[model samples]
Target: MRRLIAVALAVVLLVAGCTRNSDGAADVQVGGDPGASPTLRFRAPLTVTEPSSTVVWAGTGSALVEGKPVLIDYWLENAETGAVVAESYTTSPKPYLLTKESLGTDLFAALRGQRVGARIVEVSPASAARGMTFPTVIVMDVLATRAEGDPVPARPGMPIVTLAADGAPTITPTTTTPPTDLTVVPLIKGTGDQVPTGAEVTIQYTEVDWATGAVVDSTWSTGLPVSFSLAGLGAWSQGLVEQTVGSQVMVVVPPSFGLGGPAGSELQSATLVFVVDILAATKPTAPVSPPVTIAPSTAPSSSPTS
Candidate 1:
């Protein structure tokens, strides 16, 4: 029999660089707002005395929090040659879920507590570059933090859910019989932005069978949350849409929503339960432009008046 667990985790883009230094003048000068691309000005072949970072400008918006998604635009250049090694300016700003696993300690520390719209300049020695050929100077702009959605009311007669200090949920079912229709209850109300329909969401979840009360699968055991498009999730898609970041939800699905359909397995007719914590959500992709078409011009010739 197939299990009903769906684990989708966000892909972390690891950028290697050096440590951050305070109380020192920047060898590389930088300019730009958090909303636009960055402009780096420095002497090519600039020598780095030590690893350090400087907040060229502080953002006046919301402060950044760890373990959440942050949108950032950055440009990395070789200190010696001033050549561009990497950048996200030409494309969309990248979403980074800040963690030691996803980013280096230095880069993660440098971004901690930074506000949306803040710009920073960082210098790292070759040693900090993880044996790269040249030292690096990276200019970054903090664009925005992921929005947390609004809260929903908890439903009655559902399973009781409690969280551990570390944020793992324990589900205790109330009734023996499974629910006939889809049942969704919001246990915790989040005050952040509302999650848009079909947005890609990062979450940790657990699935269990109502009959046996056995956990089919859980993302917590993997030690990290997963990412998936809400629209892509067939059975597990209802309670997540429009949920807020940092909010926990409980969903009860009938056999039709469970994997394998009704004829596939005995458990396919069994009720499925899920507890989900929405960590973050990504912005939808921009709409593409339609193809251009050319047409012949229609005109009349002019005659000279005598």
Candidate 2:
């Protein structure tokens, strides 16, 4: 994950005017589709007295909410020489929380009220960072960072799932005895690519113990999504392999397929219920590496034997 721009600078709100001298960002010419790298045209040695942002195209998708994750593809260049400084189009878009601290003041202002699919252009004065002696220009494309799909009614006998306003899930375990075998259910069918084994996946999930209905872990509480190799999550790797991006899936894992904890721990022989939102997935071009070990809150120094 790439870090955002320097946070030491002050906030600069979007300037409102029609001429190049009044709003430098409006003077910039942006060309290209929404999701691709944009072609920027402006005179060399451009002078920007203050930071300004101009929306190149307004989006029709959902509005970006505060504290939620925002995905964006950006191209930053030196305005003076019209030289490229950094960009994300060559690789993948980066994710950031929609907060002043996470996106810096200028970026936060530029994307604050925008919706998914919007393209924006921002021009700012020089900063203290290396190679940033001259003013800079950035073009950004907003992308959805949460699951967006057609809701599918879950089959009977599955755990009851409810969603918060921001898309976090709450799983209510059934009163009946838990299933003894692994079960996979797709609660939201996505239109994105199907996940493959060993793919690097980014997800937000809540894991509960079926026997107690207690939420033992949740990515929602942390306020950020996590990405990892799908090689060592036991039933997760098996159940999510064929799932599609932008999907919300529920997986019930028996003790045999669950992440076994230390002896005498509640998770050692417990059934694990997981509600997962698959945000993104990319198949590996090289050999997959083993997943990092995640120690449970009640576990000892040793790693789980699963």
lDDT of 2 by residue, 1-306 (tens): 122232111212232223444433335667886555688777677776776677778887789998787877678777789887776554345667888777777678878999988988777777665235677777778876667899998788778999988888988888777888888889998887898887767677888888777987887886666666675555667778989988999988788753646567768888888888887676655322221112111211111234
User: What clash pairs does model 2 have?
Assistant: none
Q: Give Cα-based local distance difference scores for all models.
A: 0.57, 0.69
lDDT of 1 at 60: 75
lDDT of 1 at 134: 68
lDDT of 1 at 108: 76
Residue 201 local lDDT, model 2 = 74
lDDT of 1 by residue, 98-203 (tens): 6654556666777888887677767665662264556677767775432234545656667666666445677776675667887877776665456777666656
Q: How many residue pairs clash per model?
A: 13, 0
- In model 2, which regions exceed 4 Å deviation? 1-49, 77-93, 129-135, 231-234, 258-260, 284-306
